[model samples]
Target: MSEPLLSADAWTDRLFSDGWVKPSGGVIAVQEPATETVLTQVGRADRSDVARAAASAKAAQPAWAALTADARQAILLRAADLLVEHAPDLAPWIMRESGSVAAKAAVELEHAAGFVRQAGAMATEAAGLVLPSSPGKTSIARRVPLGVVAVISPFNFPLVLSIRAVAPALATGNAVVLKPDPRTPISGGFLIARVFEAAGLPAGLLHVLPGDAEAGDALCRDPNIAMVAFTGSTGAGRKVGEVAGAHLKKVALELGGKNPLIILDDADPDVAASNAAWGAWLHQGQVCMTAGRLLVQRGIHDAVVERLAAKAGHLPVGDPMRGDVALGPLISRGQLDRVHAIVSDTVADGARLVAGGTHKGLCYAPTVLTGVAPGMRAFEEEIFGPIAAVTVFDDLDEAARLANDGPYGLSAGIISGSVGRAMTLGAKLEVGHLHINDQTVDAGPHSPFGGMKASGNGTRISGPANLDEFTTWRWETVKAAATAYPF
Candidate 1:
């Protein structure tokens, strides 16, 4: 067993700018969603703080970018090592702050570390290309870092989400201002700062400010910030894109998802049911890539639904810190109400509640809904809760239609014994990520992760995508230069 990250008497109360500093926007009470207890109070950033942070990042970026790639890589690799070393403490902190079960918390920590390491390796990758040019001496295109970037991450998987953008941005030679959701600031914001600080990253290269909408808006509108990387609800992402775009700043929006898990007739019903349950209930279905709808071929729909309901009914739900539970509480009372409202509305709209549609405090039980149709809320909306909305489809065409019907195209999965058939069906779906014989809720540190249509702006994060997201291209024409001018 590992000790908790923050002791009762010692709490993180400051935000990180050039160094740890008290914020001007007062403080936000960080609560344990499972128990509704105030775990700590963290400093909140207002517009003024955003300006200062942005200015600091802008000022530091040039010097940081000027460093050798090996130097930058060394720093990022150290940060990755630090995350692994601190995982015992950090995992428990994530479990408490984000309402993640122990397994999920551990997985998030692992993913975070992997992302940082991958980003570090990216530093040494080819940063430019030789271009074919008109009869000049030489021509080249080089990737240069954006001056300063604003990274806005959500609460559900805060550590992974925040680091996915921050690590890559830093590795690509950009400074970052991180705005983590206030709910899990410790895990989302301060933890990254601590890791980097321990890794000996220079001051002002990174800033972690836990703030509200105003602070985020300020970051988007701030003249000093060159780009914005956002991961959150579609509505919030749209706003960030709009504001950032109006300022002519580059933006990467990894938004919401109404992902689908399609179970074909050939798939084993019990196995498919188990996969669906894991995809829908992991981290209480708070993940953006969670299977929002389970579209089953009519042949196996009944059997799959039955097994899924049984699993949902038996899976444990409780405070993660207090018990070994399969599913933990939703982030807050408001989120719980929203999830319940969708469930109740879907049930009223003729969807059958097969099992588990109740709550104890903030902990909502794993719910299974059957007879869910296309128009029902359960089938269409991204219900960020532990509810499996099962809908029956007649054939491959119908399955494809149902899976592609939603506005979001973040992720989709097809479970079929025939890999060829699953791959064929997967190719037809309008999704950014498609998995054959697997669940929708999956991501890798080295994969290009993003969405399509309303889910995002088609900009990806991680792997090679980071080069495009965090940097811009500068085309340089050289040698015998004066003879090249035509104008």
Candidate 2:
């Protein structure tokens, strides 16, 4: 089926009877990898738009905060049900709008559904504990919503990533100002907003403002915005941190990752090879936790490399909407150029392209590289494309040590049959999440997802940890004893 094309005179943030307009339009716009149709524009937003959104958020937040968690949960659950009902509507847009393969888009929707359910359940149940400070002193701490939160999500994994922030923020009573990536806005925010509106959400609690940087900055730096949650690249994350810090607002930023995947000598060839292929190639390797580096023990390096290359070689790089392409285009041509530059520089630095370091338009084949060094561009940079670099190591200790060598410590994978080896390596590896015998990004709704070091700020997705990100703790020490105080 062909994607629904926008009307001739579409503009940014234009509201319609059905849904809001996507700013990206016409020829000079981001396109779907499958059919190469204009999905949205990469337009800019100014300070005024930000201020208006912020004002709206500030206005609507109190009513949202006044509602019980159970009430909020009910709304969220209704939204979840709506999402399931509209999966048919959503699936196409996700694929056509985000350049995501149908299968990957389905997985993303499933992740969104799971996260919504988890968040709904957590909305009312998410609470802080009362700690026993001293003998007679009551140290009871209660969790309170931060009033207003700003969520800025990227184009890749738009539905899932945006929801991961929105669910928790809404669940915790913070009215949200969401700025979805202009490149692929697609009703990711509108859907949530519609659900909230249907659930009798207060006027200003769930504002969806999808635009470019100036607008995003306004929301982040707004005085009324008590918290800011952003997920993007390292460069943008830093800017968000700066603005958020200047505002004295709490912020959680999940930035870039140049992840590593380690394969031990004892790992199964079939499992390790398949896992590594998907981990590196899925979503065209645009994942923040994509295995940019694959380190294999020297004893098994040759076998692992051969298997990995063969697997990557066999993987399809077809149209994303076909549900066949194991790979798709990078988010943009700019991103493709960056990946290309990295591959070129690595090749110049003596890395051998074992297979598929090539491209056609925005699409690139799943590539495998050998002879990568710590100092090379591919090793140092976040190659957010279907290019996996394999380097052989002599020992497990050496692999662990080398895995921790990079600046970005988002996530890492270990392929080993030895439980002890996997455990040891998992512990020692300097990353936020570690996987054993798995070659995929974190499957998280129950697990916390974030990175260590420069990979992220003090924020996470999923599990109990996510709800706490958009809130602050307020101590309410009631006198159950009816006494003055303890000294």
Candidate 3:
């Protein structure tokens, strides 16, 4: 038989700690969703692999933390440069493994590199605080790494999500045991190891273990792993949180969202439609902050819905390797099926399908739904696909209520000509990230990115905020005068 274009032989035996080595777990084939072709095979880690990785991370933590912050900063900056330099080689793998278009692949790589640089800058920005003390006594409080962190990232935007957590954990002087979703192991797992190693990171500092749920559970339950940083669905996050809580481990979660985008009466329908398309269809709407629900003012509801339907019809859904294709195949057949089922159910429940909804294989067309109301599955649940469900609001009060009614509070957006009006409405919506005259898909390397309530565990995971997730505070006090004890 002819060899596969991307072979398992290249990654099946790979494990990085102290350097690239072999893992004990066997391998599983990774398929390309666009063609259902075997793109490659990746090593499958088990509990023993997780234990070994955790041990390696724990062993390296002390020395890695002992290095001066400036030294660590330099290393991370170098890794950032290396990420950009190697992006071209890595982008194709990302495209094949995750079914990302060329443009989307490039964006993910760029954002990942920017994340590393931001984390590098954070290395020197803040350390701790000094407090005033009583006479003959000094008090100092500082942040320190939480020994080892276990990072479990999802398949969507695999490289960026994984690296964002990994970079910040490393920047804060903590070692990481990363468990990338098994489906995108090469780009999500082994590639991270190569980049950091090329940047001269020490051995045993970062371990990449590509595995399934069992591996993730083992990582979460490991006593040596001081904390867990995860980005995935709320369902999976809840299970992870349960494990972490049972073991009393620190955990940070970036979970699902059923976000909203509101259009004011005075807003331009064309502008709102443009923003809606960008926010709802980017990355095939697989993003946690995708604007799945749109609240349009009654005055412009029909016009905005028509414009969005036209936009959806025009988006190209084809092979991700093609330059003209805007929407690509989903990451797996399961996700494609789930999205299609939701769209079907919503339509059966009286929601109007204004535009595309069917799929050919894993490629689903950009979909738009109208006449969706409260108490309906389409309006209440998260559709992690290129589907935008629209509802009309009579006034600002109703719009704010509809926006805040959902269980998710990850992100929301408003488009209004008046800045004051937008601000007022934005204040009333309960969300972690709010955008004015924009869409809910906005994110930046230095931005504090996360959600509130079920969307997250009260932790933000970008810029300096991420440091809090990976480290703990220690207070020290010294007394120059000997004190007499009651004992």
**Could you say which candidate leads in lDDT?**
1
Q: What is the RMSD of candidate 2? A: 3.8
In model 3, what are the clashing residue pairs, if there are any? 18-203, 18-204
TM-scores, one per candidate: 0.97, 0.90, 0.96
**Winning model by TM-score:** 1
lDDT of 3 by residue, 1-487 (tens): 1222233454666665555556677877889989988877667888998898899889989999999999999999998888788777778889888888999899998999999999999888777888899888989898988999999998888999899999989999999999998888888878888778778899899998888899999988998998999999999999999998899999999999989899998999999999999888988888999998899999999989999998988888987876579998888888888888888888898889999988888889999888888877778888778888898899998998998886789999999989899999999988999999999997879898999878998899887687777789999898987899999
Which whole-number lDDT from 0 to 100 does residue 202 have in model 2?
Answer: 64
lDDT score, candidate 2, position 243: 84
- Runs of candidate 2 with Cα error greater than 4 angstroms are 1-30, 40-44, 126-139, 479-487
Ranking by TM-score: 1, 3, 2
Model 1, range 1-487, lDDT digits (tens) per residue? Answer: 3343344343356788987788899989999898899988888999999999999999999999999999999999998888888788888789989999999999998999999999999999999999998775688999999899999999999999999999999999999999999998889988898888778889999999999999999999999999999999999999999999999999999999999999999999989999999999998999999999999888998999999988987899999998889999999999999999999999999989999999999999999999999889998889999989999998888888899997999999999999999988988899999999999988979999999999999999988788888889999888774753677
Local distance difference test, candidate 3? 0.87
Error of 2 at 190 (Å): 2.9
| TM-score of candidate 2 against the unseen true structure | 0.90
Error of 1 at 282 (Å): 0.7
Query: For each candidate, what is the lDDT?
Result: 0.91, 0.77, 0.87
